[model samples]
Target chain A: MVSKNQIKLISGLHQKKQRFANQLFFAEGVKVIQELLQSNFELEHLYTTLNDFQTVHASKRTVINEQELKKISALSTPNSCLAVFKIPAEKEIIHSGLILALDDIRDPGNLGTILRLCDWFGIEQIICSKETVDIYNPKVVQATMGSITRVNVSYVDLKLFLAQTKLPVFGTFMDGENIYQSKLPQDGIIIMGNEANGISEEIEKTVTSRLTIPRFGELQKTESLNVATATAIILSEFKRNS
Target chain B: MVSKNQIKLISGLHQKKQRFANQLFFAEGVKVIQELLQSNFELEHLYTTLNDFQTVHASKRTVINEQELKKISALSTPNSCLAVFKIPAEKEIIHSGLILALDDIRDPGNLGTILRLCDWFGIEQIICSKETVDIYNPKVVQATMGSITRVNVSYVDLKLFLAQTKLPVFGTFMDGENIYQSKLPQDGIIIMGNEANGISEEIEKTVTSRLTIPRFGELQKTESLNVATATAIILSEFKRNS
Candidate 1:
């Protein structure tokens, strides 16, 4: 049974400011919660309709009814379980290998999907601009499907970070060299831009390499690929021959 | 001005049954509405806050306030405009070149993203299982951006359709041959499966070529790519060399 205060706290974690203030974020569903439990993320509490996660200590787990679960769920349709985990302090950027840099990605789902793609291609580090959506957003946690535990994501001043990095910075542009023809390196930062805008100007200036995924469709009226799918193709190209 | 009756009609289009019965669907936002107007889709009516789309006959356009748009819109945050288009009859499936077959894509956003990806890669035909989300779903039309104007999508019995196809059929599987090394054909059907189930067992038998996108992450714990991103990778692979 969850107390009134606990429900308020869990519901408040849906917002970035509240999550930051409490140093905690919650993930719903058995899969994500289980992954968090196995990873370095420290669990604050667990609320569930089912009496699962038997390994969790009695002090940490609360058996709640569906009505109680609905009160704290960020989802429109509440899952059977929701686990709150303390947000670990951002780790030092692992400056090596293929690091993905985001130029103000605003969508939580896109960020989450990109993280899953990074995990699939073995790209370990992600550097997000200060304007990017928070990784702890409930929608992002749901979209990541457990990949949140596998990647290291850090939000920083992207322009400053790009200026100082020794690694080659890559960003896609229409007038840039074709990605299929370009020689991609194992160690570089691939910058994906905002949904409505391509990479911001200051970040574009820091890009050492500019690449383009050539459009194959005949009409050429299709404006652009969604950022997450664009990242998929770019990552696949970079990893295909390696 | 949007009348009470008009608002009810537009709101009802949110459901597939109502859309089909009325033989109409609505798209929100200026870009999507503009694309639909330019395409073969017949404009049933348009409701907008702005006095834009000067080319549209004034008789077909209704200027309404944000509050009125909110009552008729499917989105939580309504866009500036919503346009209802008569659902065009499905076109004949283009038999040649690369085709994307969705087993049972349930999410409207994924279907929209895949359509956009198909447009990017010049995959002209999309065959969807009957269970797949309707292509004319407002969320899909929104997510497609403008690509909905270019791609041809049809719903069919995917199992029977696959069983009779003359072209080589391809589907991704964990144990399938490495896609990067495989000799991908210029003409084939690439089947993307359901969000949760991957490919159904009966449909799996019809796949003549089994391909896999190799995982590069070191942990090997990452399960699978999201359906839309996976579609991007597969479509990119097919077009990169062609």
Candidate 2:
């Protein structure tokens, strides 16, 4: 049986401030819980309907009813399982892999999708600006669909990080050279920008090379590409051309 | 002053059947409404707050109270203006232009993002399998931002469409030719598959050339890429190589 206090505590994690103070986040759905269990991520608690007692160590599992599950779920329709995990605190800067730096990315879903993309591309560490959405946001946690366990996401002052890193910084710009034709270094930070805004002027100055995914239509009426979509194209070209 | 009947009418457009029966869909926020008004789409009604009216078109707009706006709004926080527009019934099929055919895409946001990509790339038509999510879904509409106003989306039997059309049919596959080196046709259908499953087996048979976006990281464990991100990269590459 799950206690009322336990439900309240798990529900509290839906809020960012509460999550940050507690250093924990909630991930719902049976699939997400199952994936997190096998992961190296530490599970503070797991609540499920199936008495998934056989799945984890005694200290980590909690058998709960459907009514109790609903109280802790962020999803509109409550799922059978929900798990809370402690956010990993140690994030090491990898000097030689394909690192991604997000500049003021606001959407939790976009951040989560990017996290999944980073995992798919084998990007080791995701460097984010202070203004970027927290990876632990319930929406983000859900959107990653289990990739949160594998990818390391850390918030850092992007300007300071870019200025100090002794590696090539590639930024996307309309006037920049075409990404298909441009030479890409094997190791560096590929900085993606805000949803509506391109890279900030200060960070733009630090980019060693500015590359663009050339528009197929070349129409002035159409606005620029979405930030996350652009990131996909850039990553594909970088990896494909390399 | 907007009547309760009009408010209810706008709210009803939220559902797919209602949108179809009434021949209308809702567009919210200042940016989306402005783009809709500027596009070829015909507006059925426009409701806005007084603050928004100061800069908006005079005389043709309906000035509504915030409470009334709340009644008609699909958003938790309503924006400055809301518009109900008649979906354009006639869309020119430019056979010579690059086309994007989505087969049973389930995610509204993914479809919306693809539509925006079409707008950015100047892709005039996006053919959808009937099983694909409605373009007017609130989540999809929100994700497209304002690009829905510019892109044409039509639902048809995608397999039949692929078979009937004389142009080349390119589908993404795990073992297909690397997208970077593939010789793409100037004008053809680029068929993207469903979320959980890629292109359907039926659609797969008709694919003239199967292509794959090769992943960069050697140890990547994920079976396939996100459909929307893959769409973005594929579209970019097809345009680049052309």
Candidate 3:
């Protein structure tokens, strides 16, 4: 049974402001919750529909009914469990190796998908502009599929980070060099731009090299690839050759 | 002003069964509506708060307020316009070129994203198993962002389609040859699988070539890429060298 206050608190974590205010964010489903439990994220509480997660202490775990689960669920179809974890402090940016930089990615799903992509490519560090969607957003945590535990994401002034970085900064542009032909290096920052806009003008200027994923369709009417998929292709190219 | 009957009719288009029953689907936003108007899709009716799309015949267009739009809209934030279009008869699948075959892509967004990727990569044809989500799903249509006009998608018995296809058949798997190292061809059916259970067992037998997008991340615990992003990478590899 969940208290009324607990329901309100869990639902509030759906918003970034509440999450920040409380220093807590919740993850749903057995898989995501289990990952959070195993990682460094400190669990504030756990609610389960089933008697699973027996390892969680009695004090921390609540056996909730589906009706109660629905009250706190961010999903349309509530998963079996929801676990709240304290948002750890943003870790120091690991500058080495291939780093992904985001210039104001607004979508929670895209941010989550990009994090998963970063995990797949073994690119550990991600630097997001201050305006990018919060990684702790419930939708993002859900979409990450526990990749949030794997990839280290930090939010900073992107322009400042790019300006100070010693490594070459790469951003995609319409008129840039073909990525397929370009000699992509292992040690550099790959900047993906906003959903509607490509890299921001300020961030674009900081880019030392510009790359283009050439569109092959005969009509060539597609304005751009979705940022997350574009990231996947770019990371694959960067890692394939390395 | 939208009549009660009209509102009811348009709202019904949100579901696959209703869409098929009425042989219609609706697209929201001026951009998507305009794209449908410009393409082969026949407009059933157009609703807008703005006096745009004036070229649409007076009888076919209705000026409705935001409240009216909210009633019929599938979007959380209703766009400036929503247009219902007749679902045209499925075009015959173009057998040649790089044909993308989906074994059982269940997600509407993933299907929509793959369609956009196909448009970007210039793959003209897509064949899906009957179990795949309907292309006319509002979420899929919204996510496609007008690329639905460019690509030809059809539903068929996927196993039979692969068995009879003269061109090479490719599917991604854990033990498959590395896609980066493999010589991808211009003419073949590259099959992407369902989100949870990838390329069904029966369909696997028909795949003549198995390819894997090698994971580079150190931990490598991420089980798989989202179907759409995987499609993006696979399509890029096939088109990159061609």
Give me the candidate number with maximum lDDT: 1
Checking candidate 2 for backbone clashes, the offending pairs are none
Give the winner by lDDT: 1 or 2.
Answer: 1
State how far residue A119 of model 1 sits from its true place (Å).
Answer: 0.5
The order of the candidates by TM-score, greatest first, is 1, 3, 2
Candidate 2 local Cα displacement, residue A29, angstroms: 2.5
lDDT of 3 at B193: 93
- Model 2 lDDT, residue B33, Cα: 74
For model 2, the stretches where C-alpha displacement exceeds 4 angstroms are: B51-59
Q: Write the per-residue lDDT of candidate 1 for residues B153-172, one digit (tens) a residue.
A: 98999999998889999999
Candidate 3 lDDT tens digits, B1-242: 99999989988888889998999999999888878888889999999999889999999999989999899999899999999899999898899999999999999989999999999999999999999999999999999999999999999998888889899999999999999999888999998999999999999999999999999867898988999889989998999999
Per-residue C-alpha lDDT of model 1 across residues A1-242, encoded as one tens digit per residue: 99999988998999999999999999999999999999999999999899999999999999999999989998899899999999998999999999999999999999999999999999999999999999999999999999999999999999999999999999999999999999999999999999998899988999999899999866877779999999999999999999
Evaluation by DockQ, superior candidate among 1 and 3: 3
**Candidate lDDT values, in order:** 0.93, 0.82, 0.92
TM-score of each: 0.99, 0.94, 0.99
TM-score of chain A of each: 0.99, 0.93, 0.98
**Which candidate comes out best when scored by DockQ?**
3
DockQ computed for model 3 against the true two-chain complex using alpha carbons: 0.88
